[model samples]
Target: MKSVTRSLRILEAVAQHQPVTVGELTKLFGLPKSTVQRTLVTLNEAGWLRANRKDTTRWEIGARVLAVRPAALQGSSLFAAAREPMIRLRDAVNETIHLSVPDALQCMVVVDRVDCTHAVRTFHAIGDTSPLHATATGRAVLAHLPQADVEELLERGLERFNEDTPTDAEQLRAELRKVRADGYSVNRNQYRPDVCAVAAAILDEAGTPLATVAVSMPDSRYDATRLPELGRLVAETAQEIAGRRDGA
Candidate 1:
């Protein structure tokens, strides 16, 4: 079991920092050189890691990892469950509604959407990852994560995208607490200037965060005065999605 754990850790480290060398891995994990080399060899043979023939000493993640991801994600009911609610939320708010799922340590957008009324508006593309401390959708998902995971993210530190982005861990934690109490999160020009968003988490039967549903609009359309109402709509929509998933 310890060997398996170490092997998985090596795989995770490689995945997180691809095209890494054994020496880098040894330095990063403080592991013995021979152990890292042997683990890499086993993983490479199992097709979980790929090595460059031109530079056999370096390695990157293998294609097998990505091949399994789509299948697993397809098995999830989030897409089917969120499609209608996303459309309705977009129409109700005359804005874009996005569905994002946690991918590794970040949240990635699985759907890009816009209301017919706002067809010209720019929208986040599917597969775009939101900053955890800079966007409402990201914060909503983070608010539901385990405290350990949250602390890990904080220790990694927040990346600043704009003036409103929270770079302080304590402040971000306070905001997450507020989100937990209010059942929704709001971001105003934290990610994109002149844009605003409100988001809430869709929970699974186990009360785990399945995804985040968010409505985004221009600051002109969704100002501070209307944030509470927008937040309520997002929370209700997320709850409905969660309930349907639980029932299913």
Candidate 2:
């Protein structure tokens, strides 16, 4: 029990200060170096922590932790900042709004949602995962990521979930470019059949994407003429959330 507690604490510390060293963790916990090293190793073996790619001596939170419990971050500043804006976006667009964070370039995990009053609407449960190349929420974040990282993900193969899913590398790159230019992404039956969505990424102070805010609805209700309006609304909401998150 004591060992489990120590491992959990070390994992949380690694998340807070990623690429941290055993020595730093030891100092923070006041534990023996050997004990701290053992706990880190245990967490690493369990897929909760991983050694930094450039520096093996430092540890960071692993993909499994991000994949399993995105909802656990509901208490985080990002979630707190996004909640009201998401609601307002939903009210304005009359569509379900989602807040999703990237999962190490593997996919986007939904962390929060604000549902619309429509009887027929699209929905993604909290913790739902979506492909980066196929969804508006996913591409909104993907468009802002480093090109090398984006290339690495594309090299893994873009599985076509629907006819609209952009499988060609050059074509997807073009779409990403448009996303960067437009400040938002649009999905028309791309990931899931008959679902349409518009989304924008929330960026950190470094201009790196932190999460995405999306407005989703059934294709029957989608109006091409409303794209500009809906896109603008989602983008502004995302910006507001980012500002609030940074305490600006």
State which candidate has the highest lDDT: 2
Error of 1 at 244 (Å): 1.4
lDDT string for model 2 (17-129, tens) is 99899999999999999999988888878767888755889998875687677667877899899999999888887899999888777678888888999999898987678
Cα lDDT of model 1 by residue, 48-147, tens digit: 7878534667888764464345435655676667777788887787888887776535444545454547645546765565677888888888888889
List TM-scores for all candidates, in order: 0.70, 0.79
Candidate 1 stretches with Cα past 4 Å from truth are 1-75, 112-114
Q: Alpha carbon lDDT of residue 186, candidate 2?
A: 98
Error of 2 at 142 (Å): 1.5
Q: How many angstroms is residue 131 displaced in model 2 relative to the true structure, after the best TM-score fit?
A: 1.4
Where does candidate 1 clash, by residue pair?
none
> Alpha carbon lDDT of residue 143, candidate 1?
88
